[model samples]
Target: MPIVEINFDGLIGPSHNYAGLSFGNLAAMKNAGAVSQPRAAALQGIAKMRSNIALGLTQGMFLPHPRPNRAWLTQLSTDVDSASSELLANAMSASPMWAANAATVSPAPDTADGRCHLTVANLRTMPHRSHEWPNTLAQLRLAFGNEQHFAVHGPVPPAFGDEGAANHMRLTPSHEAPGLEVFVYGVAGGAFPARQHVEAFRAIARVHRLNPERTLFAAQSEEAIAAGAFHNDVVAVANGPVLFAHEQAFADKAALLDTCTRLVPGFEYVEVPAAEVPLTDAISSYLFNGQLVTLPGGEMALIVPSEARETASVWAWLQRHLAGNGAIRRVEVVDVRQSMANGGGPACLRLRVACDPATVDPRFLVDDAKLDRMAEVVASHWPEEIAVADLGRSSLIEAVESARAQMLDLLDLTQLASG
Candidate 1:
């Protein structure tokens, strides 16, 4: 029996398998320009264990050190609070609009009609993290005029069993994601940080994590997904074979395929056959969202596939998919490639946020606080560059369109309700 894996929806935000978000667009919180370039006078030994993709993510700040001078930040500051603030401040400064949009409830940029928020009356809370964050959840409610619901994944205990205080949360859809999902699982105890899930998501996470000691445990780490969750799972199911970064499990690759199938058998696996294939230093060199993306600059480029080389298979899949739908009438499979001997894939580059599914759940309909809560998330992420002016315009467009689509679906489901 040929081994294959399945791609399933109903996992939360962004589509990668793990996360630490509890509400709205968290990625928009950080400075997009922060990691545009490295500050090292001499670009030597920049990466070690991971590729340039890993280092460039500003992970250097969180990873303890980027240079041989590991204690550089601590030496510059007296307290971790100052260091953390400075790090964020540094990222914010790189962008022209960090301090300007400091407050969450600050009306969307360039709008001067009342509070510019939905629940101007009273908003709510948003999940917080040491990572670069934006306005509070309360402010987000103000942005959407209290109409949309926002939710993020809270950190949780690692499936592998980290001691305490989950550094991250795998924000998978308890219901369904609109776009993509990446999954990683590991042991309860590992060299990695522990899990930390907020008040939400306490119930379903443990089963999501198994023993970190074995290959199955290897499947239990963090996940990251991009884009929103579609109401329809039928759209979410992938129609191709599973591709891996490397045969990470080596001889156990067979069992890994079996495990993926058991997880979602409707999907299949297609491995790039191993013929004593020499390993590359890249963390992962797979296709994403129909693009051949890579991070080539790494401490050890030879060991990892950090070089942003274009893969032809990825281009083919993308051309077929993109030409089928979307606004592009004509398809151009231009090889927009770059290199960052980086740590991981686009999956690792992103984080998860809201993942509300278009389901007939009474909970979704009854929750009066849903949309209002969502607006709060919107507020938290709008940095100065993406002003409330522009953000609100696009958001309104999306909301109106979403509501219209949902209404049509409701008309169909009315038959089911009536039955």
Candidate 2:
């Protein structure tokens, strides 16, 4: 009955492109229309997973939904025969590559029924990402439908936007222990829209039957939101007793940390002072967005992007952090520049779930053999570079469809493919 946290990363899909569809994501906007390498992106992601496996970490993967997302196109009354308009451009978005937005998972330890609960994100705030719920839900139901241990709920009502785990954080003394669940939402933000609604956050907690005393709802700072910390994960991340964040990450940050200390034993707060690293630099380098993972030897490691290592301020901060030798003892820099170009980082590409492996769906579990096969498919079939102008080309569509279909076959998940 021992429980462990598994990282489920989304395989960069064949349709990976720089469409600049996300309004709040600076990199997505800056790199809009640049040529994207689907093959390189997928390989980089797979390689990261492999490295984690080598480190004895449990890893899983979620396949990308087929694109140009016919379900979305049909909703706009557009068909393949006449789908050449720019209006359908966002429909081709590969936003699903950021699986942290996939769904909010409540481990059995935190739920009242003692069953793990997963609710897909509505993602209704953005036109480009709004269509992902149905497809994401399909994958969830198929992978977690073993009803004895899991209860997969539909997306929250569209009236209230839900951005999933991107805005949720769970704090436990250990994977098997029931602990406090923190739901971060934004109320007053600048021009950029606040994605996680307060109502949605409350509803999710209520539906999961989380103990009210153990649940805390924190407000994301407006400054962080304006600086492109569109999701709470961008500004803060949690791993067991440690909550790593920026000084300005949340509104009334001191009180929030105080509450966590009172609620969870051995709770630790690690903050990067605002004077040391400005919000601009934090968002640009994604310093706070790094994945805080508990290593096999009972120590924690920060899996960060190369950008963080390259940025002078972030680099200095990390060096000092490692020097402190507190909860986070190691720093591993990964090259996910392809994904970073679209405003996602190591943390953004994954969803962390704590549970017993036997209770979960085996189809999603990843091992060395499966990783090799998926890498082979990427090299053989995925396109090296795709431009915005080429998004509507029949040849590009054929290549994307073929590559995804083959990936599904290799994973024995052909059922997820569009017929």
Candidate 3:
């Protein structure tokens, strides 16, 4: 079984806006109430997917969950037709655009049954996101329903919060080999609540039947959490054999490094010294949130947000690191300012699935032709901009519904369209 890691990016939804709904996310709080360009956000997201595909990487696209979520509104004792108060507030959430939080995928090579496993995240940490699991599970079941090679599980109980890939990482000698899975969780830190629960991580591992010997649990630093590293991925990311992280990413950074090296010889740890790049600067610029990818040529590349380039410390570090003879050989910057404003970046916008491309539903795969078609739909139907004040307008609801319908139809997934 030859497994390749594919980046499945969520197509930005039409209702994207900065409402500061996320409690601990610094970027979201700082940009709240600002007008958002929904059209540009969707297009920019597509362009990022297109660029990765152009580099000969396997990429997939997942449709956004419908917003002004009528079901959620109904649950809150109000109908979408006449929603008010917290019902309306929850309806306006655009948190689905950050798909990396969508699910935790354990590829076939890392699972006990030799089937790719995906567990949708409960995302119970934020009120705006607690209602997303049902719809997210529906989309996952449709895209990965192939029973022979894939297993899609419903989220763990909400008693313990799980933020999916944001708190999970897998390291294999190669994509095709059996590898180690790292689950990172945090206790309390500062005024912010810890999002990833240790019990939830352990439960997910047990459900997936991952080898106990190969599974590792690392504690997220309280310092990182208080400094706005809400998720471990914000401070560290792991690809194949490399872990690119900040010095304070984990509670016992040196011990974790030693363990990884012992588990898999030649495992590389690219830790950015805190002395060089402070934790505050790392969180602000999203230095560790960049996508660490293996290019078609076998050389590695780091796909980063433009904000990382603008920050002097982060920019200087990348230059010095890439200039040296290291595994990461190239750097590419992308503009996802809309998502960035909402506390997401390149890594936050995608879910990685390691498997054979042929096994996936072809409808979800990305290519030049499909990218063009998606772009057409976005250009013609997506709202040019959305503000917090626009949430109450019937026109905005109509626009969101209409745009999603058009997108579903264009992709030949009319079954997924709202009735």
Candidate 4:
């Protein structure tokens, strides 16, 4: 089987808004109460997928989870009108737009059964995101349902918080070959919550039936977490055989890289020193949150947010690195300011799964024509703007529901409306 990495991005929801629900995310907190342009945000996300396709990458999509989550609100014994402000915000949260937290995927080559495995993330640390697993699991099951090629598992117990692939990385000679899987977890001493628990990943490894010798675990720097690097991908990302990361991304960087060198053949790294790009600058600009992808011509490119280009240190580093013949040969800047304000970038908006595309559900895949049609639905039905205070309005709720329904209908995925 020819395995390729498919990026499944979550479509920005019609309810996209800035509620500042993420405690450790500086961008989310700083931009709280700001009016959001759902239509523009969704279109921007669609354009990003289109760009990846143009680059000869296989693109997939996961629909927005049903928002104004009445089911969750009902569990709390209140409806939108009667719920507390925090509860209401949690219910209306559009944070699911960050698909990087959707699951932890182990490609077929790395698993004992020779079948790809994905475990839906529990996201138990944040109340707003804690309820995401069921809907996400439904979508994962639908997309990777071919039993001969894939195995999808439910989330680990909520006792162990797991933020998913945002905190995971894999290094291999090729997507089809067995790879060394690195699970980066965090310790909780930081002022901010460390979302990915060590035990959570251990549970996933066992469930996935991965080889013990092939799996490695590392601790995310407490400094990175306190500086608003809530997930490892915020400061580090790996593609093929190259690991691109900030100097301060891991607690024991030397040992981790040493282990990686021993386990992964031809392992390479581009470590950005903190002296050059301060951790604060890194988190704020989301320099590493961009997708590090292998292009069709066998060169690697860093797909970064436009903010990275604006940040002097980040842009300078990229230019210097590219000029020096680093593993990242090119930097492709994209506009994801809408997602950036909510503390996500190109990498955050996608979940990377290495598998044979033919084994995956076609409805979850996209072409230029499919994306064009999706963009039309977003323009026609998505709300133009959503003020933070307007989250409770019955009109906004109905509009959000109607817009997502239209998207589902357009994709012939109406079955997910109830998921």
Candidate 5:
């Protein structure tokens, strides 16, 4: 089978808001209580998918998980009407928009069974994101249901926190070749929570049947995590044979790269020094959170948020990087400020699955026409803005529900509404 990388982005949900639910994320906390533009946010996400398609990359999408999750509220033994402010915010969270946290996927070439395996993330570290696994699992099953080519597993036990692909990186010579899977875990992050537990990723490797020799586990630097690089993706990203990261991203950066150089053929790295681009600048601008992708012509490009361009240090380093003869040849800037304000950038908005697109559900795959249709629905139905205090309004709840239903109906994915 010919394998290609498909970036499955989660459509920004209609209930998208900034209640500052994520503690370790500086952007989220900085923008707390701010009004959010759901319509603009969803449209921005669609535009991003369109840009990837224009670049000759395969693009897929995961619908927003049902919001105002009444089921989760009921699980807490309280109705939305009577729930505390915190409980209501948790139930109404749209954190699922960051699809990178949705799951960890090991491509067929890297797994023991020669079939792609996906494990839904428990996201157990945070209250608002903890209830996402069940719905995410349902979507994964539907999209990659071909048992002969794909194996979808439920979340590992909640005792250990797992933030999914955000903390995972796979390095390969080619998309079809077996790869070196790197799982980055955090032990301490000052006052912040370390979301990816070591044991959780170990369990995923076992479940995916990945070879221990080909799998590497690395510890995220406590400084990086304390600087608000909550997930590894915020400080490092790997594509094909190249690993682009901050010099301070890992606790043992030299050792990690040494192992990759030995295990991964033609492994190359571009490490930005903290002196050039301070860790604070990297985290605030989300420079490392950008997607480092191999374009169709075999040249590599970094897809970054516009914020990266606006940051002086980040932009300066990127220009110098482009001027040099580096493996990453180009930089593509995109507008995802809405997601950025909520602590997700271009990379955080996507989950990369390397597989033959034909084996996946066609409904999840997209073209320009599909993007056009989805954008229309978002513009027509999604809320203009959501104020923090408006979360409890009956009118806003109805609007949010109706907007998602219309999107589901348009995509012929109403089945997900009930999941």
Candidate 6:
């Protein structure tokens, strides 16, 4: 009954981060220090609105609790917010088509299991929402048909940042074109040791054909009501190193690195405490191309474009401990500081869509030249097109939804009968 089978593969979706192929060291250093006149001038408007702009920009996707909120902090975060917003806008305006977004999914070799995803947040926000999820998922949906027999992981109930936690959702598609099988989890509560959270995520891994005993890499956040949630399904691996245990409230720097004892082969990262690893020094990013997009919840492959990529580091304590893994993509580029400051590198800006169970998908297995050419070809047809990587999620969804509708109309049932 399913077009694709579930494999114990992992997540297949787009994400945005603060690391990627950088513009170069000189450019990065030039911009690294305090804001320049023009840059500062641009930030003035944002700063006036809020005082603490830097923190907002540097803050990880999710941070832990107990940090005092000061009036100055708001101002600095606002600056970060303003800068991030402008960068996201630039990325979105760069895309030529709505293909940037696709159904968010993970690979599952079991039956038709997969991950289902749809984000429920103001993606327009600077570092937090910004263009990462929206742009990544948008193009993916476009490359792969939207609403397919795949999985979707998105916002749950109570909204993110609500009740000191965010709600996440996973959908299993029985059908595409509004595709869904079962909403693996329509409403999930807290992430730490909560049965509700475990059951919800476990449902997705089961779809992916993953053994309940296997370990899973999960994105963590101290502010997350869902801390330690991933441990329920399988072992959880996190990328960001530095997390504040729910019990610790602050953060245990030593414990952060201790968690890094486990790392997947081919990808190696040992946890290092924040005091030891400077956040601003710079880090390298990786690329993911032609990789199979696996969905754990939905039990099917969601549509992914040709590639996806990312780069990340665990600078904050809260994010590191809670999130088990950063992103795992092939390392293509390195040290993209300018790009990183804008809040994401190559991998951070992509969304994957494909149901291929193999390590590689033939259609997606092209070299970088071909991938660029594909974007070029698509761009030629539409002048408004920017890099598929640039567009935001809302714009991406609008594009893919249109594509599916058009594809349905153009296919002629009569032609099949004649052939």
Off by over 4 Å in 1: 1-153, 157-183, 186-245, 249-251, 274-277, 281-306, 310-345, 351-419
Tens digits of per-residue lDDT for model 2, 197-234: 99998999999999999999999999999989999988
**Least accurate stretch of 10 residues (summed lDDT) in model 6?**
58-67
| C-alpha lDDT of all candidate models, in order | 0.23, 0.89, 0.89, 0.94, 0.95, 0.26
The local distance difference test score of model 6 is: 0.26
lDDT of 4 by residue, 1-419 (tens): 78999999999999999999999989999999999999999999999999999999999999999998999999889998899888988998988899999999999999999999999999999999999999999999999999999999999999999999999999998998889999999996378999999999999999999999999999999999999999999999999989999999999999889988998889998899999999999998999999999999999999999999999998999999999998999889899999999999999999999999999999999999999999999999999999988998999999999999999999998989887
TM-scores of all candidate predictions against the true structure? 0.31, 0.98, 0.98, 0.99, 0.99, 0.33
Model 3 per-residue lDDT at 193: 88
lDDT per residue as tens, model 6, 88-207: 333322111111121224434323344333232222212322233333333233323234543334332322221001222112222221221111121332432222232444443444
Ranked by TM-score, the better of candidates 1 and 2 is 2
Model 3, range 158-211, lDDT digits (tens) per residue? 999999998899987888888889999999768998999999989889888899
**Any idea what lDDT model 4 has?**
0.94
Clashes of 5: 0
lDDT-best of 1 and 3: 3
Model 6: per-residue Cα lDDT at residue 83 = 34
Pairs clashing within candidate 2: none
Clashing residue pairs in candidate 4 are: none
RMSD of each: 18.6, 1.1, 1.1, 0.7, 0.6, 16.4
Which ranges of candidate 5 are over 4 A from the true structure?
Answer: none
How many residue-pair clashes does candidate 1 contain? Answer: 104
